[model samples]
Target: MKIDTTHLLSAIEDYIAKADEDLRDTLENEGFVAASETVRHIGEIEDALEDVLDEDALEFLERVKEAEGVDEFLSVSWPDIKNEGDLEKALYEIFRQKFDEMFRSFTFSWILAEEPEIVEDISGEAIDTITKPAEAFIKGWSGELSRIMNLNTKDSMEKMLLKAQKKSWTIDELAEAIGDSGIRNHGYRSRRVALTETLRVQSYAQQESMIQNPLAYSKRWKHIMSDNPRENHIAMDGQEVFKREMFELTGRNGETYLVLCPRDTSLPAEETVNCHCIMETVENENALGMTADEKKELREKYIAEVNEEYEAWEQKFKNDMGIEEPRDDPSVTWEIYNSYYEAYRKGEIA
Candidate 1:
């Protein structure tokens, strides 16, 4: 039996787009809170630095004053001033705490609510399979956030110190530089982390739903184009593979690796960050446990009912909007289509 997937794909895409917007708004607010906390924590670290200026710390500063460049300055360690270690520990804790808060506020229940309509056939036992990947993603993402934050803290500290030495800054000036770094550097990183994680969760939940559906036979990867896209990901666009198989990609270091899905959490940030790819399922009618005639009757009934409902809605939309000139369709203009589609999805239109 041939199943037309135009409506299915379109519905899923529309649902995902709305979910992405909602997730982005929620996560962006959380990111603002995290960024503010990061700045406050950095201020406390700077205060600790001022309080620890004993003789040995002063000597370390003098050496830093005489140093030629960042490399030379870093070679002379301040054994007495323990703020660097303390700052590392503080940032690491902040990341872990913030990530946990974000995860707690997120919910996966909406994913399952839409599964029966979208996936068509999934037992209660199979529905539970969707959560396993989501749980694994959360664990992996939390660890990755801690690792990135720690590395960023170390790198920013080095840059702040080097800038101070080059400009002959006083202690207060150096502290101000560090404070500026905290505010300027972390704001974007917070937003980026929020966007990446939100998209990853949505993708994982949908893909797992497809995997559990009895009619789903295989999946295909479709890459989205954007400015400064990754060459490797672009190459993988439109590649069809079985649901259980992996997509092989070569890393920048020329090492071959495999990923089960586009935003696989086990992979590094380079491969997954800001990725806009999607996975679509290829369905098989034979797997539905129906005879040929029964399958044909079911398909026809489903398509006819959906088409009738959609056609009436489309005519009403065109008349209400007063579009006199004939175009290919109302969806030819994306802005108009999106507004009406979103309204319909929200049940604003009868």
Candidate 2:
């Protein structure tokens, strides 16, 4: 099955652009009116946040009840479900799984709902990468809130755990500024954090969508090809790219590499924004002719050959220029490696 990287990338970009526009409108419509409100009423905002947490805990229980049969919920599951300690552990796991599904489903559904042309299967790894941070954040937030609930209240452990969200009022700001440094900092921090946490799921899904399509293409290639490519992975990008890219299986100095799928690595958010790079799986058919062990041995041999070439070139340049210092020049070596690889590909050298 051929995954259309172009369509997927465009859908993801379009979704983000639309979602961000909606979010900006929400923030502006909500935020503009609040500038004059000030911060004396921070307590009200805290109460709202608490209400979110409360609703989440209760809602989770409701979901669990709905998902599990009465026989299951009332049976062995009860022991763990009712046990405060065990329940918390179970709930976190449940939340992690639930949100992972929710974000993936929601984001994918959001696109399919609108465009309907974006039909691609997403990988578990990609789903986890995009959704895990938000899951961790929510888990931590809920756990912390549960720890602080009033024991005297009718609040259950579940309610305590889930009680959580942000912002408003003019005197709210003035009171915060006047009362305590932490108060202002706290308010600011709370709003900012709330926004971040709220946005995390969507942002991650968007970021993952930005790359998952092209990524799936590589994955599909791996799945269908009985002889998977063992050589260097190639990077392909459009006419317009941060840098229209390329890759090597082995560097001139014998440095081996594996291509990273976009958003899989820890490059900054801006780096992946609108990035059109897709990895082209390049396999050495000759490498596949050998057994697995033989393939490994050949790789080691190739590395040694490259290293020897590098050492000889460095020595030659050093002696020829009469430079006492031996410098490892990447640019010079890179050209040599490129030429060698190009020649190798053309059947001129191996």
Candidate 3:
């Protein structure tokens, strides 16, 4: 099935604008950082979705049309419903059921609500809310989907990774395994590219975390500190601990190390905004032959590369937009990446 990305992008932009307004009002009135952050995160997710939709405009349109049809069906007249309340409830139930089915069929994942005003109702005000963020979300999600599709374009390579991980086959693999699958592209280049990008993000997050919590570094990495462990020993082992813990948690088999944000502490509200702990894998670390200093140097070198790439991308975006002076907002970038990652995990973006 095909999908249209434009409609989805428009819907997401609207949703994000509304969400930002709501979050600002909340933050200004009561200093509700958590709630405000949630809204901001949603906005980022919307932005990510927009990026995806822009990549494959046609397919996005098709999916939106299908979803709209489902919504229309739920709204259409039913022969047996007589009460308004019953009708509303019935429509909600039907929409939820149908939406779930559609998402499963398409291997898409995202949150949907019976009422767009649900958040406002919860917030106890007539806050601006997107009644149907999905319309826009799908559009924004398409870009990521296209990237994922491109990554999973090879049959043998797809199977190799899945087999290595010992996980059940995914939609990408299923489509490839079956000869009649609609998808065409599937290869290692895509997988490697995706993995590398993810690693870069992880490294960025780690550095941001460290910069935000300098004190935490001493407490967590005491071994590296000037004080001896038996004397004035601090827990200056956070970065190393974080690296080990994250590697184990991701099941990368110690291949990947947490490059950024090695300690777990509440950062300043601004710094912690949309922070997602990510880890990077060192090739030599996997070989178990590299010393700690070697690994650290390699990670630092990789971080430099990530920063250079980021600067290039930022410059390109500014050039494309014809903006002589771009706003320095890490929060915005964080939100965008976080949103895309959330959509991917949720299957909202293939």
Candidate 4:
């Protein structure tokens, strides 16, 4: 269940590349990204931004044109999104599917350790391995997207307005000054979310592996940072420190590092977003401490807990959304969505 950083990062890259291609398809001939500087429209920068994009960006520009609200567009359009084609939702679903498939293979790998003769599915219990973390993944993904969007739109628009006050500017001038920050923000934020989600799935698999076969390995968690050629100092320091340390290592200066877990980090932004660090669980002698019966009991209890958590989430989702959970789909995606949305609605996620 350790973080396979290489595999995980490649997964993220594939997702981003796919997302960009999908978004481009959505944008193609949609009047979302402006193509030409037709004569009458060439005069003003505002017109370019207005005609340059539609969908969310156009919605935002409409607010500006009408002389209305500041944060007029999607103050996070996730709530209104219903399908898979949405940028954020699409990103989540991609990782969800990939991670689920990977974890299926991941869960099956345990069979190879002792019972090499048979290949069997955990059947009912397998869904929990994905649903539980997926619940958190969506919530985190939405939160991070909102944060990046707010900062990018507020700051970028403010600077654009400031510069526009001084003199008239062309489409290129204003765009260069303000930048297509929304795209940048989304791209960067998506990377962070994708990386984090992939790791989380791996972490859950680790948990599942541990519970199912406690004696298989006394798995100790370790932080495995990337050998990214463009790695930064904070990541380097994190790599150096946790590279040799174990899980739950505490700093002499009272800083705490949850090595294999997510969030609650003391690292600066320089290390987190686009970060290539990962959690790796290695076997230790203590793995043999738990007896066979104890391992089975632990595994049963864990699966039960995961099932309860997702059931509760699904129930709440049904209660709150006034719709039955998706009966046709194999994934607990809607259930996870409901859980995370409630968290966001109650302000518990932040």
Candidate 5:
């Protein structure tokens, strides 16, 4: 089949534009939940375009003709190119990889939309491509379009963490390293707290319901809580919450006990940040070598610790926010309580 470069390019550009729009929506809404799906679909479309480009190698030859400033050149047939099939395959593979890389650039922007520190390093071409439709026509295909862009956002974050670790920096330092000044300054504390508390309540409700209603648990919460509790906490909190949980499973030989312990939020003035209290699990006698009964006792100890930590943190948050007294009415769910607390603290709802 003859390749249709114009049609293929148009389709690719259109898909890319739609992908960019979706990415923007994700950014504006802080919707990382939907980001990977959006990017995956865009990647699939880009791959199809690469296939079209491979089939239409003649269009590339036409570009070469224009580049050499010749009205016409010897028409190069597909077979005339050296190892044309392998060459076309290699070219398309390279093109697809490059397109994926570009898509990743946009994806990273979406990921970090709240903080655009990397924007300066992004290419004008990338920005333009994301902002406008691809050019109507282009007659050139010798070297690949070498846009200077980095798509290794995960690597960047890892490097930042490593640098911070080397310096023995705390969570506040780590947050700053990742361009999250809000975390450092406790600026997003309210939203972070609300999100964290909501997730925590949902998690607690699911777990309680799981014990009470195994069928409902199997239907709804089973898969969600499949991870080790600490990891599950991290996934739910994401970057919005910078707290950590440690789980230790203890039991006698052939028996199992669970204990949960949560570390305080590592941010400076964590109390002011309205951080969520974490629960840690301590397992008995399996690997960590604690007796089963000891594990149970420690679990209770940790719960007490968690409550004490939260009480202090909550008191400070209230003080900073100018909440003179804690709410006594049972009507105060954690979410409503924190929202009111945050508003009062920020002087928004006073």
Candidate 6:
């Protein structure tokens, strides 16, 4: 039976546009939570320093300047201040809770926007695709978020020491400088996370929705330029591919990548961050010249094949990354992600 997807596609487009528009507010709200934690952590660090230096910035500066290293001074005086793990833990929890909520809500809203006749029911296979990948996505992002925050802390501390040596400042002045450093910009960092991950989940949801859709046969890439547009993405506008096939994207180093959709976590941040492109699902006019029952049968068979392939890949990925299972406190690092991404580019993971 032929399926009319004109109305369904329109609804999908409208829903996506609305989601895109709301991204700014969503990011700001998440950023506010992160900002609150950042302020609290910075206050604690300042208090710890005061205890060690007796609120004498000049004395603290002179002692550190004479020490073998800033790290040595800090470590000897206030060992507990080195524990920026508190910030990492706080950020991870914020991201974990937000990601879980976004995934479920976005997926549900997308389904609800579909034409009733087109979406008879959601299947177990569809649920599996949605839930499993979302869990992995959240775990991976938590690790990534912590890594960035750790780097920020180290860099900020180094800068703080340098600034103290460069100028004659009171304790309050030094404290203010520390608060103004990059480590204290957790709210801005959270906004970046929100923008990228929101697109990630939305793209994943769109792809899975098309895969579960009996009438969806292909998808076309429609590139929407952000403030800064990627040349390759612009060149790929109107590019079409099979629903299950991957899009070939070229990196800055001229490296090639196969990604399922825009902002795919599998790709490096250079390619995925703040991407505004979209994949528009195309319905088969005649449903491939098959009845509804036949279409459903074909979809089921495809799902089984795809699931088997995916399970094997996921197992290999976990093994290669040494991730036995997802955990609340993920220790995965940026190096691990880069190594796996490199391996994937070389077709090692497949």
Candidate 6's TM-score: 0.62
Please give the distance, in angstroms, between residue 201's alpha carbon in candidate 4 and its true position after superposition.
3.9
CA lDDT scores, all candidates in order: 0.51, 0.36, 0.32, 0.42, 0.33, 0.58
lDDT of 6 by residue, 22-86 (tens): 65444334321222323333333333323322322333344444555444555564344445365
TM-score to true structure, per model: 0.49, 0.25, 0.23, 0.44, 0.20, 0.62
**Residue-level lDDT tens digits of model 3 in 276-327:** 2322222222435545455344434544554554455445555755758645
lDDT of 2: 0.36
Model 4, residue 121: C-alpha shift (Å)? 4.1
lDDT string for model 5 (114-157, tens) is: 22332335465533222100110010110121111011222343
Residue 72, candidate 5: C-alpha displacement in angstroms: 81
Candidate number achieving the greatest TM-score relative to the actual structure: 6
Off by over 4 Å in 2: 1-102, 113-115, 118-179, 183-185, 207-350
Q: Which runs in model 6 stand beyond 4 Å of their true positions?
A: 1-73, 77-83, 111-118, 121-131, 165-171, 185-187, 226-228, 252-255, 266-270, 284-306, 314-350
TM-score of model 2 (CA atoms): 0.25
Q: What does each candidate score in C-alpha RMSD? A: 23.0, 22.9, 22.2, 15.0, 25.1, 13.2
Which of candidates 1 and 3 reaches a greater lDDT?
A: 1
Estimate, for each residue in 81-154, the C-alpha lDDT of model 2 and write its tens digit: 44444333333343344335545654453334222233334356533333222333334434432333222122
lDDT of 2 at 227: 38
lDDT of 2 at 285: 39
Query: Which whole-number lDDT from 0 to 100 does residue 31 have in model 4?
Result: 20
lDDT of 3 at 249: 18
Which residue pairs show backbone clashes in model 1? none
User: Which candidate has the highest lDDT of all?
Assistant: 6
Report the Cα lDDT for residue 304, model 5.
53
**What would the per-residue lDDT of candidate 1 be over residues 1-350, giving only the tens digit for each residue?**
99999999999889955755664454334222232333333334333323322222344445545556444455555322324444434444444454333332222232233223442363463333323223334444444444555456456556677676677766656645544555233544554655565456545554544444445567778777667788888888777766545666665556665666677654678887877676666777665665545543443454355446545655665677887675633123333433443554455754
